[model samples]
Target: MKQKQMKGVCLLIAGILFLLLFFSFSGIEKTKLLDTDGRNFEKAEVTNVISGNLSNSGSGKQTVELKLLSGDHKGKIIQATSSQSYLFGAKCKKGMKVIAIINESKGELLASVYSVNRGPMVWLMAAVFVAIVVAVGGRKGISSILSLVFTMLCIFFIFLPMIYKGISPILAAVLVVAFTTVVTMCMVDGITKKSVAAMLGTIIGVVFSGAFALIFGQVTSITGYNVSDIENLVYVGEMTDIKIGELLFAGILIASLGAVMDVGMSIASTLNELKEQNPQMMLKELFQSGMNVGRDMMGTMTNTLILAFTGGSINTLVFIFAYNYEYQQVINMYSVGIEIMQGLSSSLGVIMAVPVTSWIAAFLYSKNQK
Candidate 1:
């Protein structure tokens, strides 16, 4: 117990140090994407609604009286027009907390409802999620949460910064994947052979996933430039050293990361348990057992990856059918090709990870037992 605590402290310190380094030198502080010089965001509450002209349809505009709860205009009353839109906008109601965009020009205040204040609700949901995980999983749940946080931090801080700093986005992503695999496995099961095997298998699986995505892109002539929002991304690329082209493969690896890690860790952990339960189990027997378990997981996990990608493209799929497009045109579309490549390549990663993890676990466990 003492050793475990000490190791945890060390890992925590290391993570903190890594974050400090990234924050200090990654140039994230210098990257300003928005022009917020004259505009300020403040919390406000809708005290009165005078929207006799408001339309029930998701369009038109409504006049809302807001009571500023924060910022320089605290406790001030302001009237703002809230535009109701299909994709964006807030339906202002009495006592509704909202974000107000305040723009000052010529000693005048021009305020509008920027968005609904969803911050508190988001935090509330997160707290509930944390409580449930802790209640159900106990120590393991705590470890899972820690690993989750660490993974997100690595992605946002390390992976994003590297790409922004002119590094090859795909290469930086792979490095981040490798780093996170080691850290996450260690968090879950310490430095045991099981975690080691999982980490190795996961790294290899992620690489294969990304490689397959690149291959698919090449064959289909679907490069990162073909992705939606290329205009904005290209604009950012011109400002920074960002690699806009390799983001597709980088995204594929990141997307497949969870499923591949799941396969790798599950097989490795199962094999470890089997070897522990029966020390006399031969290497071949252990390998076969791992393969049997992996086969069962393969179908569901592959389906999961495919379904996830399919779900993300649901809008695109709806548009294709809505327009009554032919199957030929649909299959040949770049959007469809990107979705297919992401799903298949990532699923392939999960499938291949099974056997690789199984074999690695079997070999290490058998050898360790001997």
Candidate 2:
């Protein structure tokens, strides 16, 4: 009725605001470093596989006939050679999609296979995820999807540009996390005591994660410079205003965000429900109840966070063992140190959120009923 109409109007206004702000972030220019000035990448289908020179690795140079599907080259038929390396290109079959890199330099045009066109499959997988989320969660799933999109846009659009402008990476991450947390919680649960508690707890937990990374990294001599890909990033830093340091801590904050927010929201929602169920409960009783619930959740949530970070390093772990590195060597490796830091710091964030969220929810619930 009237209430539903009012809620709809409010949601519409919020959506409009989010879209306007998100699109405006496109005005922030990205630093160009790649020499892509004379290159055009267009989608093309392999209409015919003309020939291949097979090597021992089953990958070698090949000539393919392509029908361009997009860009100014649409409908053009061209013959191109695949990059000889196994990592860059592969033998093609008819009807397979590949990316055609057209170079217009040297007063001539050259076409080659840059890679396979995997864009459709990637988007298809993403679509499946959205479908499953919506099918399982219904309305809450829809709200969660919107919040997820907002968080992504905040990262790639606003947070990235801010850091590129020489802003402190950690500071920019915090700002983005705070903004996303408020918007996410509000979107999920509206402006209520529980959502407020969740927002505060989420922010505190994320900051704690980043802070631990900073302090721990200092003690372990594991700065951002220790990362495996620092050389490439250093080149980017030299070319642009990007802050080369503190990206690790910023990443730690962003990585821990989902787990920390889950813990915070769970505790807040649980405590609110407990308070409503036991209206005459004392403040001490409510706090104890929250602590009890938090303790139960602490183990699994911390494990989840740790496992998530560890999962990203499974290959590194395998390599260490496969190479038969000694205990001393393995322990001292920068990759190992980074993985350990990421896991423990993120777990600590989840751990901290449990108590902080529990206390906040308890305090709010114990207030005099309005």
Candidate 3:
């Protein structure tokens, strides 16, 4: 018990140190960027709102008093204007928070409302999610949360920074995915046969999914520019020399990793328990048992991956349907093609992970018994 406590303390300290290092590197990068425009972005809270009519437009204008929450002019009160249009306006109310942009181009400091602030709401939702996970999962939940944090750190610190430095995005993603798989499996299952099996299966599955996405994406001529923010991404790519085209497969790999990891771990852990309970069972029997469990999980897990992708772009589909797009046009559209590739590739990962995990677990457990 004391050893476990010591290990946990060491891990906590290491996590804190890693976070400090990550933020230090991020701050340096931010400072290195050239700020040609003398504009500052800050969060602020609305103290008051006054509504006024727009001349000959049937729209209204909202004049707000904001108290800055961050940046050099923190805690300073300023007035900003917002248009009350349903299409392109931020409808801010008193007590609501907003993002304010400070412009100092013409020797005068002027502030304007940028958008509604959703950080607090997002934080609140995250807190609720953590609370539920902890309540339901207990010790395992804590490990899960730690793994999640580590994965996010890897993405923000290792993956993004590497890509920003002109590294191949696909290679960086592969490295991050491999690191995440090992860490997450170890955290959840300890350094046991199950963890080893799950990690191996997840890596294989992710690689297969990534390769499939890249090959088919090329075959179908679905360029990464199909996405909504490709122009912005292209601008960043021009600055950093990053291969924006490979981002499609990189994104598919990362998105598929979690689902593959889940399937891998579930099958391996189940088979490990089965082996423990029935030591007399033959290796073939154990493998068959694992297959049975995998078969049961295959349907819902595949649906989960497909449905998740579908849900993300349901609005696009709705728009297409509303416009009465022809069947051929709908299927041939780049956006639709991308979504299909993502969904199918991820589902393939989940499908392949089951057998890979089961085979590894069966062999490992059989060897252990021998």
Candidate 4:
């Protein structure tokens, strides 16, 4: 009866997730967008650029009034402005073709210049992922989904904000990684020997990644602060309070945390299940069995981690290509090369943690048996 009830609950959740994905992919609002092709409005011409003093703090902004020369809103003029204090610090000028988001109300047009086009496809893809998880994993799927959300929040709030406050990035990241390791393991596996073993292994792996990042960062002259956003950030705010180097260091550690946790828990659970299957095995034999499972997991987990980071940074490769940088020049480039090294180093940490943690967990758990 309990099994039947659990199956029912899983089916209900899967149904709801499927419905959400279906509705999102149906494009119920695609017709509402003003421009579908994401093309620039060449017929729109900015006729005026006026400077106005915004708070008399000696800082002002420039506004441009644009007139549409063609299309459905011909001869209609709209005003667009840029704040001087904005991070981008962009200034508007005349004769610039700009794409805008438009609002239509009761046959009247209200065009506002924001993003060029809508991104319904991205949301649809996320929905599909959610549906697949729910359909396959059931209640455990829900826990995994919540774990992902918690990870994102920790990175954005606890990790990034504290790093920006001039905290030691490596220290802050280690703390965050430790916290997340415990949280995710406890949530997924509950508070048990397996969870503890996974947590310990994850912590050790994170430390390794952080230490390697610091050493490489110093020796290679890679501060990880030379990215484009950091350049814009310097002009926009007082970065004297922020240790960008530390933030980068922390980012490297935190980046490894997710993969490390995955490997640790996978080994722990696999070993635990192996014990259940082979209750007659001695502790030493069980430890060996766990190490064998971990070895298999290490290969795939490292590949997954490295490939994920590689795919995420393909744009950096594209940028190097556009610049006509030679292979040696690209490899020697501080930021790109640093990330590549960090990704490889982190994967190595994950690989080492798996067997070590699995051996520890299997030894302890098997010895505890009657």
Give per-model TM-scores: 0.94, 0.92, 0.88, 0.66
Candidate 2 lDDT over residue span 1-370, tens digit each: 4645644665576567656756755576777788688899889899998898878876778999999898876898988888667578756889989998987777576789888999999999999999999999999999999999989988887888778878899998998898888888877887778988999999999989888999999999999989988999999999988888889889999999998999899889988888888888766777787788878887998888778878898999899879988999999999999989998899889888877887778778878854
Predicted model with the maximum TM-score: 1
Q: List residue ranges in candidate 2 displaced over 4 A.
A: 1-26, 55-57, 84-86
lDDT of each: 0.88, 0.85, 0.83, 0.68
Per-residue lDDT for 264-302 in model 4, tens only?
A: 888888777777788877767767877787788878888
Instruction: Mark the 10 consecutive residues where model 1 has the least summed lDDT.
Output: 21-30
Q: Over the stretch 1-370, how does candidate 1's per-residue lDDT look in tens digits?
A: 5658856875787688677757765656456778777799899999998883656675677799999999888999999978867755588889999998899888799988888899999999999999999999998899899889988988888888888878898988888888788888888788777988999989998889998998888888999999999999999988888999989889998999999999999999999899889989988998999899999999999999999999999999899879999989999998999999999999999888988888888888888565
Candidates ranked by TM-score, best first? 1, 2, 3, 4
Clashes of each: 0, 0, 0, 0
Model 3 shows how many backbone clashes? 0
- Cα error, candidate 4, residue 356 (Å): 2.4
Query: Candidate 4: what lDDT?
Result: 0.68
RMSD for each of the candidates: 2.0, 2.6, 3.6, 12.6
How many clashes in candidate 2?
A: 0
Show pairs that collide, candidate 4: none
Residue 350, candidate 4: Cα error in Å is 1.0
What is candidate 1's TM-score against the reference?
Answer: 0.94
